[model samples]
Target: MLEGPEIHRALTRIAHEVLERTKGAEDVTLLGIPSRGAPLARRLAERIERVESRTVPCGALDITMYRDDLHLAPARALGRTEIPPEGIDGRVVVLVDDVLFSGRTVRAALDALNDLGRPRSVQLAVLVDRGHRELPIRADYVGKNLPTSLRESVTVLLEESDGVDAVLIGPKRERGEDRTDEARTASGEEN
Candidate 1:
């Protein structure tokens, strides 16, 4: 789990890295992968503004339909993808996400970006990087590098979603075993 101070420091460092790599925030835009990624993008945008004295357009992108596993989870809800009024045409687009898991979401995001407009360049930023990538995607900016097993789940609680923003490594459970019973029993109940 990352403390608020740690997150702040990471954002500051990422801003510096972005500025250094892009040679300032000119012609730069932030596109957060919807849901958890939105707030992170907004925070990054705010930090960038503080450093550059200019508002970098922060947009949200929803890639639910574009995901390869959509058919597997048809009932899943979607997120919002808001592009800047100027659009992403000929601009550098940086995609933000909470956790980099299988890299499939990033691939879907790339497809979604292509549908929007031809970007001069596209980069990735993530809060946490867990291994087991099913694709070749890599984050341009990362907050932390965590080595986790495939069975373990990484839960990121943002201030918006959770009272406080922190990353947690949830306990791993065995496959085909129902842990709901354990949860219910711990709550003094049975189902």
Candidate 2:
């Protein structure tokens, strides 16, 4: 439903919101939930720096082992988790993600964050918040609030990974059917 320019504008707005919410993001550390989140976090950091004239720590958080549905799925490759040297302790951590659907991924990210270190506070930021939350989680900063049916899927394609930036909505795949990673993410089967 969204194209490249629109996605860029949304990210720009989200960056500004993060700065405004955190009062300049002085002690904020953005931890992106890989794979798309990592790049998104970097982009946010860059935008924040451009506006505030200071660097914001950005890194990737891998939630593979912390997922609640690990037993239900087959073996999966773990993504890289890179924390800045400053660490999360006493910092306002913003967990960035591509799409928010059932909130499972965000929950998994929170669990993983707990194992790492204690943060002053934890907040969530997402490119698309396609509601149907299975958990009580909600995003602190959202690029778009997309209302969708349970049978439909929302996919976010980023330029860093997908070579094109777009938010697509389509039908969910049948059980055991082959689908792309984006489709899997939209179906709330992966993050």
Candidate 3:
């Protein structure tokens, strides 16, 4: 769906869009969810710093503890949630995530943020918005809007985690379904 260069361009645009929407980062803070969102947040902060010529505060937010499906799934290790020194009490807090699927994660993030502190406003920034929204959630800054099927799967691989930066959309394989070259090529994955 997106390659490294595409991802870079998207982040750049998102950074500018964010500053424009908030009238600059004077009252902004970016909090990324764990896994891929953490580095994406840093990247956005870097871009914001370049455009604004000022460092933007960025931190990691772990929503494992606050997820609605925690009991439905097996137990996993909790992620780290760190707020900046200035805090989110009165800043425009942007929740950064790699992809927006069902909106449950964002919903959980909101619950988690509620425990932290009240922000002047809350916004969402996502690299890709794959349309299959299970809740009434929207992204303030979207890198791309991808329309996909419920039977499909979108995977975002970043260098920090997957050693590559690419967003691949492919069909979800069932048991005994062979991985074909067609799927690999279409998904932008090398066999």
Candidate 4:
């Protein structure tokens, strides 16, 4: 539902909100959940730098191994998790992601973060909050609050990986429904 310009505006706004909430974001470190979230984290850092004139450490945090539903799916290739050299200890960490759906991914990310180091506090920032949370979690910064059905899926395409920036909403395949790899990815089933 969101186009390139809209996404940029959202991220820019989120960057400002983060700075305001963190009181200049001097000790803030952004950890983006892999795939779409990585590039988003970089963009936010850039925007934050532009306004605050200071660089914010941004890195990728892969939650593949931390997911509770790992056994439900087949073996998957692990995503890269890179922590900034400054580290997350004693810092305010903001977890960035493309879409907040079931809240499971954010849960997995929290578990992964615990293994890494203890942060002073943790917050969430998302491009879209689809409102189907299965956990007691919420995002501190949200681009859009999209109402969607369980049978619907939200896909975020970033220019860094997808070569385009857009958000698409479509039907989700039901169990036993024949699904192709392309369809699965498009439906954000893999996100």
User: Which pairs clash inside model 1?
Assistant: 60-81, 60-82
Candidate closest to the true structure, highest TM-score: 2
User: How are the candidates ranked when ordered by TM-score, highest leading?
Assistant: 2, 4, 3, 1
Give candidate 1 regions above 4 Å deviation. 172-191
Q: How many pairs of residues collide in each model?
A: 2, 0, 0, 1
| lDDT score at residue 189, model 1, on the 0-100 scale | 9
Residue-wise lDDT of candidate 3 within 1-191, one digit each (tens)? Answer: 89999999999999999999898888899999876688899999999998889989999998878877667544556667889999899989999988888888899999999999999999999998887777899999999998888788777788887778999888765522333322212121110
Off by over 4 Å in 2: 175-191
**lDDT tens digits by residue: candidate 1, 23-63:** 89788899987677888899999999999899899999988
How well does candidate 1 match the true structure in TM-score terms?
0.88
Instruction: Please report how far candidate 4 places residue 88 from its true position, in Å.
Output: 0.7
Across residues 1-191, which tens digit of lDDT does each residue of candidate 2 receive?
A: 99999989999999999999999999999999878889999999999999999999999998878878778756566778999999999999999998898899998998888989999999999999888888999999999998988778777888888888998888876643553454335334333
Candidate 4 residue-wise lDDT, 1-191, digit = tens: 99999999999999999999999999999998877788999999999999999999999998878878778756456667999999999999999999887788888999998999999999999999889777899999999998988878788988988899999888885532443333324324434
TM-score of each: 0.88, 0.93, 0.89, 0.93
